[model samples]
Target: MVEDGASYWRRNLLIVWISQFLSLMGFSFSLPFSPFFIRDALGVSADSQVKMYAALATASSALALAVMSPLWGILADRYGRKPMLLRANFAGAIIVALMGMSPNITAFIALRMLQGLFTGTMSAAMTLMACCAPRNRQGLTLGALSAAVYSGDMTGQFIGGLLVEWYGFRQAFLYSGMAIGMSGLLVLLLVREDFQRPAPVIKTAETARNWHFKLGIVLSCLPLYILLMMSAFARSVDGSQFALFVEFLNGGVNEAGAARWTGRAAAAGCIGAMLSGLLIGRLLDYFRPSRVARTAALGAMLAMALIAIVPVHMLGMERVALDIGAFGLYFHDQAAPAVLALVPLRFMMIFFSAGLEPVMNVWLSKITPASQKGIVFGFAVTWRSIGWIFGPLAGGTISMLWGVEAIYVVGPFFFLALVPMIGWVLRKIRSRLES
Candidate 1:
């Protein structure tokens, strides 16, 4: 009976991972090139205005996510994670599809905000997996899920770019929505939850009086939440501006060429993420989470630095080689080399950077009471949303002021700053364990 139960949960987790992957893949299809869509499709002519609108579009969703994640978490704890996951995926599909049909940038931004308010499939999926997976196997489970995410992201960006080039931006969004909807169907049909709600406490005078104290106890995990936020911020700062940065590097290249290169660079980063996910479980089993996080941060910093300075010409031959090898096609462009160079740097950066979130998830799980897992994970999501909100807006503004390459120059410092915070958080966790 015990073995059967374990098997059931494991099966459910597998389904959850698949659903999350599909949903993320769909969402990513439209995200990386949103700025380009706004600029070219929507007739936003000014470069600075396009940058600003892109930032706002990204931030609008994040802002809504920041506000709604905790509430969703609470609901998940009260109801069930499965329901929340379905809700997020279904609503996300609708909103994203609507975004493609939007007549103006303003409508698109509003749809993105709506998407944020309704969607948090990643967090919900994580919560479901964490709750279902055995504690001893959590690291491996999360790592696998992370790998799925990266795989989906990489595939989506590559395919989405192709779709955008061949069909147009609207078709890409439609396809993205269909993918997410398929995920929702998979979850609704296959995933199962045996969640039991906590019994309501009879409010005695003493218990009622101590509510504030109880809340205080829960709030003590603020440092962990902050750490999660910083980790997210550090990683995502370059994401919103990445396509624009690639466009900048393309110099005189045509828009289609620039989009293809951007997709390729992003795909490289996804490959790194997939590898990191495969490896992180072993690292977590052997090393302290803080040590792993610090190493990742340092590696990311170095990779970012390399990306900032590497000459564009270094990658030309390599790009041509890949084109001929992979597709039996030859393309000639001066900027191709520079864009190709970005792939390795982006890969290295993501390879190291990808480990941080899963490690932190493991760490947070260790310290948080099991009963409060939803709330704690919710808090983490809330803070992560805040980071996402800040990263795109800040990155956009920086790109506007100093140029897109400057975002890469400034990105390394964020990781550098994270190194010490990891130590401090580790010390705090150690002290708590000792106490």
Candidate 2:
């Protein structure tokens, strides 16, 4: 095992963060424009067709993340995270650039699917950071990385909105590709992988008896994924909701102002997410992990309600009040990881969280019998992905059919249900702790 206070930052971490940041910025540049490309560039005429294309695009990415995340995790474990990050960045950069040249919807979807396959770069970079960072500082380090993720996402969205409007999709895409390619090179130059000592091998029979670990992993993962479903659902609402809200308040503005301010609406979450990412880890160190997680879930519920109940009629400071409330609630989005890190072994927690996320397999590494960890984590993630696969489709369908405001009502209830579920899981975890 790597010793505490090893020179992870001087040697490994800074490089990884820098590379990942650049790559993420690149990825961000393309995100805001994806829907526009699908609808206008791809020649989709109707709202429903645009939605279908959007869903397909998202499904392709989710499918890729769902299928490949575990495989990448396994590979990172065996080989190293830096190499995987390199591959992911290089391939992802190429794929993103290719999205610019796609003449039709078919090619666009294919390129996005291919982009998804390479999307594990962030996962790998995160895994690398976890592996190398000082154990005690895992929360802080991971928090910083979370900030990077949020910042990168926001940067990309803002840039994508601007570039797509100013220079068109092709130029915006080329910019994204260049940004990603540079990140790949930076990784190759900067990140140095120090091999990890193998974890003590546990016998299969004895390992199977570690049921608390098994239960902890399952309970933790299932709820984490449900939270993810809620977030993704909210994310899907961003484009349409921002436009509608702005228009309703501003009196049916054109797409330019809508898109410009829509970028701001989405940008609102980044500040909160970034601050949450930075602070939540420290907060975790102070508070009970379960408490923090539960608070996040509850906060999300309340925020959703605020969004639902507050009409666009609210002006000036009133709108600011709604914004603040929504922002605070959005911070709770990563409660799952904070909750997960509360598990023992701080050194491994970050990797476990990063690896297990998007697929829910970290439970095996963190909580279960080494022998059965893979199987249980796999199963848990399978269930999680099933949730993810349907969440946006179901949420989007309902929002479109009934109204987007309905999501505010429905999403909160779904997220709030997890609070109690997490309590039950924590109780189960406590039982194991007592045992």
Candidate 3:
């Protein structure tokens, strides 16, 4: 009977992992190219206008998400996590499809806001998995799910780039919607929840007195929340401008070529994230999650600094290949190695950045009562959305003022500054655990 129960939950985890991959992939399909979509498809040709509109689009979605996450989370806790996952997937499909049909930037931004308001597939999925998985394997389970997310995101970026090159930006949204719809279908068919809502409690003098203790628990978790915010901010600060940065690098390349290169770079980062998900997810099972997070943050900080200062040509190597065959057929190929210099650094950054989410999730799962998982995770998502809201806006304005490369130079500082806080939090968590 025990073995059967274990197999049952494991099967659910597999299904949820696949569903997360598809859902995230669908959302990311056109994300990397949104700025270009604004400039080209929306006819916003001015650089400043493009930056402003793109930033607005990014921030608006995050803003709505920030506002709505807590509400949805409470509902998920009261009802069941599966319904929330289904809600997000179905709503995301409709919103993304509508985005493809939008006639102007304003309409597009509105659709994106709706996407944020109704969809939080990641958080919802995480809640479901956390609730269902055995306590001892939370790290591994969440980490595996994280890998799926990165894999999906990487696949989406590459395919989205190709789609944009072939069919234009609008079509990417239609494809994204289709992918999300498939994910929803998978959930409807495969996912099972045995959630039982907590029984209502009667208020007593003792219960009223325990309010302060509950507040203390929330306060104790504040540092983790801050770390989540900083991690998100550091990563996203460069995200809005990354494609533009690639375009800047490829001075002579056509728009399609630049988009392709950007996709390649983004995909490389996602590969790093996938690797991290596998490695770090396991590490969390053995070590203090905060310690792992600290190491990753330091590595990411150094890599971002290097990425900012290093010349692309210096980091690249050249290779030539010659093919000889019958009938005197000979072909020679030369590759510019410098174009790939940032790929490794990007990998390093993403590897570490990827560690933050699952580790943080594991820690939260350990600290918070299971009954409150939905609301607490929702709060974490809110903090992430707040970071997403501000990071892109700040990145956009800075890119406009100091050039796109400047964002990279500024990004490392966000991580660098958070190291001390991380250390302090780790100590507090350890002290509490030991006592």
Candidate 4:
């Protein structure tokens, strides 16, 4: 049964958080460096084809996720969220393991689609947490969950890269699959739910339900979905091809070195994202959601602009020396290559952009009715999936047409474009508040 106290919510949140940490870590292990896997393992020789194949690998799964999220969400409402979590976790374990055994690019892409079709642990976890968490504390709960995602992803990417460098992509994929399988086991054994399916409605009530659903979605959900989609697009636009860019920077170095640098940069970004989750949720709980989102969007724009110049080592800040006489703050010159500069810039960009997601998530949960949360989140994932589809393709096309440099050039605009939409959301949120 759902208890009306802190312990009840805290217990579920803890389990969900741990589960998410493991699952996301597993996911980050393989997906983040797929481009490297394609180039080095699958033996893709053409730069353009490498970019295109990487995009397809992500896009295929996204397309399938877009089609399936709604159905799985409806099932959650009917059967309960635990089953959905189990489904995603267990299926993810198997499919992700299968990826390690893929023989060629086509097989890898096909497996990616299957992974998307069957796995969506994040959405499952979110809906379940939103349902169980106390209404007033949902922001904190979700924010913490987001932190676990970043923390796990940070760990996974770093380790996965090392594993890839040492063993191969196959071993990394296998280990990641094991991690996800373990997460499912944890959920099954520890998590508890008291979900009651909603009673069926007759024709007249169903008609009213349809009207209310449309009105609710139009008034509250659409803007949040747009913002979520925009976030997905901005984050993934260059993500799939990141290792390729790093390899390019390495002056045609081996994939092992490329994998290591890619892992380092990705791990740094996750750390930034992890820290952002720490502060953004607390602020969102007390501040206007739209205002927080707008600030994050703007911050993300500036950060991306900085990242764009990292190829030049951000004006030679990659190495510096300073000495304080009395302050006891002594520093020495840290000489590093120009390409190493991208790590901190990537971190900053993720930190700023990452805040936008939680803001929107809290906003959506606040407006959604408890009973419809599953269906609503399902569609939300669909919208996010749309962004994933477009983002990979856009990143590939931009990088292919103009060179990898174009990725950093074009990325800031995605966040820049979110500012006006955030204003629109702000007004809607304010109206909801006043009403």
Best by lDDT: 4
Ranking of predictions according to TM-score:
1, 4, 3, 2
lDDT of 2 by residue, 1-435 (tens): 233225756456676766767887898786555666766577776655655566566667666666766666555555656677888899988888989889988998888778766666656665666556554455556666766666676667666767777788778889999999999998888667666545665778766665566555556555445544443443343332333343333333232343444444444555455556666755543455666656665665666555555542233222221222464464211111211111111112122222212221121123333233333433443344445456656655664677544655666666566566656655544543333
TM-score to native of every candidate shown: 0.92, 0.75, 0.90, 0.91
Best candidate according to TM-score: 1
Q: For candidate 1, what is the TM-score?
A: 0.92
Please provide, for model 1 over 1-435, each residue's C-alpha lDDT reduced to its tens digit, 9 standing for 90 to 100: 021124577788778778878988898788889988998788888889888999899888989998998888878878888899999999999999888888989998999899989999988888887777766677777788888889789988988877888888888899999999999999999998877886776888876765565366458777878888888888888777788888877653353477777887898899999889878965675666778888999999999989988944353343443424346767554345677678889999999999888887877666655556677778788888888998888898898999878888899999899899988887767765334
Q: Name the 10 consecutive residues with the lowest summed lDDT in model 3.
A: 313-322
Name the regions of candidate 4 deviating beyond 4 angstroms.
1-7, 200-220, 254-256, 313-336, 433-435
- Give the better candidate number (2 or 3) by lDDT: 3
Query: Whole-model lDDT for model 3 versus the true structure?
Result: 0.81
Task: Give each prediction's root-mean-square deviation over alpha carbons.
Answer: 3.0, 9.4, 4.1, 4.6
| Candidate 2 worst ten-residue window by lDDT | 332-341
Mark the regions of model 3 whose C-alpha exceeds 4 Å error after superposition: 1-7, 199-216, 252-256, 311-338, 431-435
lDDT at 162 for candidate 3? Answer: 79
In candidate 4, what are the lDDT values of residues 220-287, reduced to their tens digit? Answer: 67877887898899878987778877766644554226777788788999999988887887777787
lDDT of 3 by residue, 1-435 (tens): 021124467898889889988987887788779888888888788887888888889889989999999889888888988999999999999999788787889998999899899998988988888777777788888898889889999888877877888898889988999999999999999998877775675798877865566566667878778877877888788888888877765552342367776777788889999989989998888887778887888888888887787634443344334354668876453333433666677878888777778878888777776667788888888988988988999999998999877887888888887778777767667655444
Clashes of each: 2, 4, 0, 0
**lDDT of residue 385 for candidate 2:** 44
Ranking by lDDT: 4, 1, 3, 2
The parts of candidate 2 lying over 4 Å away from their true place are 1-5, 196-255, 314-387, 430-435
